[model samples]
Target: MKFYRLTFLASVFLTAVMLLLVYVFDSAKHSFSETNKQFFQTLIISALILSVINYLVVDFLFNFYGKRQIQKISTILPEEIRDEESNLNFKQLSQKFTDLNLKNTTEIDMMKEMEFYRKEYIGNISHEMKTPLFTIQGYVDTLLEGGVENLAIRDKYLERIDKSVERLLNIVKDLDMINQFESGEIILNKSRFDLNEMIREMIDVLDLEAQKKNTKIVLQTTSNLMFVNADQQKISQVLLNLISNAIYYSNRESATVTIKTKVENHKVLVEVEDNGMGIKAEMLPRIFERFYRIESSRNRSDGGSGLGLAIVKHILEAHGESIAVESVYLEGAKFSFSVAKAI
Candidate 1:
């Protein structure tokens, strides 16, 4: 923006200088007699018109430049802006930045904050992984020490240990998957597929688990035998993740998870509803955040790695879809998301 301003000013200044030189030369050669007064008046008018036009053009151009710069900052700066209230000096700096109307500087600081946050995220994920690992290690150690002597008790502890290990592995895998999605390293292999077929297959795969929990898994659609053009594998992953989460979080020993689809406003609405531990009002805004989890009855079913929903959100967005969640505490949670209808 500064460079543009400088170049604009320089060109305007040069043009004004040439115009001034021409006016002075013409005026001097013609002299200031009554016969030449009209010509002098005409020259003055020309100079004033030129100045006004240049001023208006420069003003319009600069305002455009400022707006465009701010827009660019808004796009890339949210990840970088830090709002640390604990540090007085840093807080003051941020406040002064806002008060000073130093927009460009604000954007630069935002980038710095984002880099800091990336480091923070990595540490958080590592710590989460460490907890389950320590638990598994403790269980294994106890079994080796004494529990291994008892066949029946040893089997129980061993199974729990395996569960813990598997949970840890799932967390690690989900993190890797989210990383790939965010980095755009995983390209979806687009293919034609039946939506009902995909949902039915997931139901089949998870049937035993549902039976174990005595849950009823159902799929309903207003449109019969609807087909979609999409990356079958990627879309299936999305359904699997949502369905699995619904099954895990439902409140009752025997629960219902319903997948409903319909055409609304020229788009496909795919909703997964569960009568599970619903999300809190506060966590609703942040449920899709990477590593964010609601600490309540939902965690009882399974501790979330926090990356699953975030991955789902991004994956849908990549395919031009939008996802949202609604919940009534202890009643259940419903995830209503949309994808562009197959054309």
Candidate 2:
């Protein structure tokens, strides 16, 4: 409507000016009676035709260019494309394209990361299994070659075979648990319980193992019976994993592992810290990953399944909580997690 209106006004204005010019210039050459009326009529008809032509051309060009741009953008982002009736302008479409481009870039980066992790995960699993499998095979081969006939080394070889089998079983069980957690198959049975008491119970269960290394399990907290709302059994497993890690990794002849708890911000903050050989800064981020171990401690013959921290992570995530670790290279390592306070 505006285009047509502007065209009409322009055509009328030009026609009026032309008519005035004709009168002024041709009045000297000829009389302005019959000739002037004919000229005026011709000019009026020409102006009306030109106005209609201008409106049609302008409207066609505008619609054609607008629809073409919309089509091009829609090919890339079909879901984000607006309907024909929408009042989307060129600037709005450009902004939408920018946003879509950013989202696509981010998704691509994430896919690349997941691919890297997938390959690494497969490699780690293969390496972990092959080490024990080959050892067990070698022991069996030796036994078959008459080592079993000699009662002296026979028992030693058998014990080593049993330990290898146990390690393999632990890895498989831990992997299964991780899969169940990831698939949401393990449902947590939540209950209100005394968290301090539970920690003490864990310490008691691990007393013998700690005694072997002369590691002291100390409980340091503001209260003796801090209550928490969580899955009691699952939380106990978490405590066992963390405290045992501290004990196993302690490098000193006599190490002190402290279990501390305090009520903070409607939650109980629990920390299991050990004065052990702390982890390096670079290894901290990957510590919770399955089968990931620091190179320095990788050869240490410990009873860990290498999935303790991973299990702890999954269990805490199932409880809708997070766990964190802090450590210096040679000072000590601390693992902390929060639980809901029983109100």
Candidate 3:
């Protein structure tokens, strides 16, 4: 409707201009000296013919250009929005272009963010591997340069080299485990187990390490047997990591790490809290990221491959659960997670 209206207006304007030129030429040639009626008839006939021709030309050109523009737009539009039965007018086309531009900008920003993380991950891996490799190389070199003759020196260097090799192996092993989890290669073998008993066992295992830090691990739970449905091995690893971290990061003279559990609805809520140097609030978001450390000075010497918390997070997530943490810097921190209660 709009197309025909525009062409009609344009044809009228062009025909009027052409008629004016014709009138001027006819007056110069005295062609109007015939009857006035005949003169008017000739003018009307000329106007009708000119108007028809102009309207046809304008309509053809408009359709040709409009189709070309629509074809270009169709190529860029998503399949969901493209319509062959209906013509997209100027307003709809403008809106689609705006939406496309915004989508492209968002995608570009995400790509840039992923690129940054990729670079950071590569650099962290290199640094971690380099430290252990260098330590092993230095100690081996010392042993080769006449240091092997002394029994004491050889023993000391060999021990240090062994520790470095172990650290390298730990990093590789943790990385592989995390990769398996992320790639869906590790399957959880869910079983019903006593959550309380597991926590007690973990405390018994880490008791000596806690004693070295003058930290006492205490389990506070409402029941002696809180059964949960989860992978027993992975949950044990989670408990170990959390408890170990609590013991390691405790700064008090005689710190205390507490494991608390309670039955809530159809789930078991387990928390590992500690009276340690808590993490900063700003660093909480990245706390579970692989190789991320709250304290820059902490290294593999502090007894972690830096993938413990990351593994804990992955384990819980695989069980259709999540972990949460709360802390006040220099005061204390608590890590909590939940599991399905066995029916």
Could you say which candidate leads in lDDT? Answer: 3
Worst 10 residues of 1 by lDDT: 82-91
The residue-by-residue lDDT of candidate 3 on 1-343, one tens digit each, is 3475655766677867787867765675575565667667777887787778777777766775676678776866676457543466556667776887899899999999999989998888888888889988998999889999999999999999998889989999999999999999999999999999999899999999988999999999988899999999999999999999999999799799999999998999999999899999899999999899989887656466888999999999999999999999999999999999999
Q: After best superposition, candidate 1 residue 176: deviation in angstroms?
A: 1.2
Better of 1 and 3 by lDDT: 3
Q: RMSD for each model, in Å, please?
A: 12.5, 7.8, 8.3
TM-score of 1: 0.64
Residue 133 lDDT in model 2? 87
Q: Which stretches of candidate 1 lie above 4 Å from their native place?
A: 1-104, 146-154, 296-301
Per-residue lDDT tens digits of candidate 2, residues 242-302?
9988987777977999999998999999999999889999999999988877554465235
How close to the true structure is residue 224 of candidate 1, measured as C-alpha lDDT?
A: 72
Estimate, for each residue in 46-99, the C-alpha lDDT of model 1 and write its tens digit: 778777877876676665665565545554444334333222343444564576
Error of 2 at 74 (Å): 8.1
| lDDT leaderboard ranking | 3, 2, 1
Ranking by TM-score: 3, 2, 1
lDDT pick, better of 1 and 2: 2
User: Evaluated with TM-score, which candidate comes out highest?
Assistant: 3
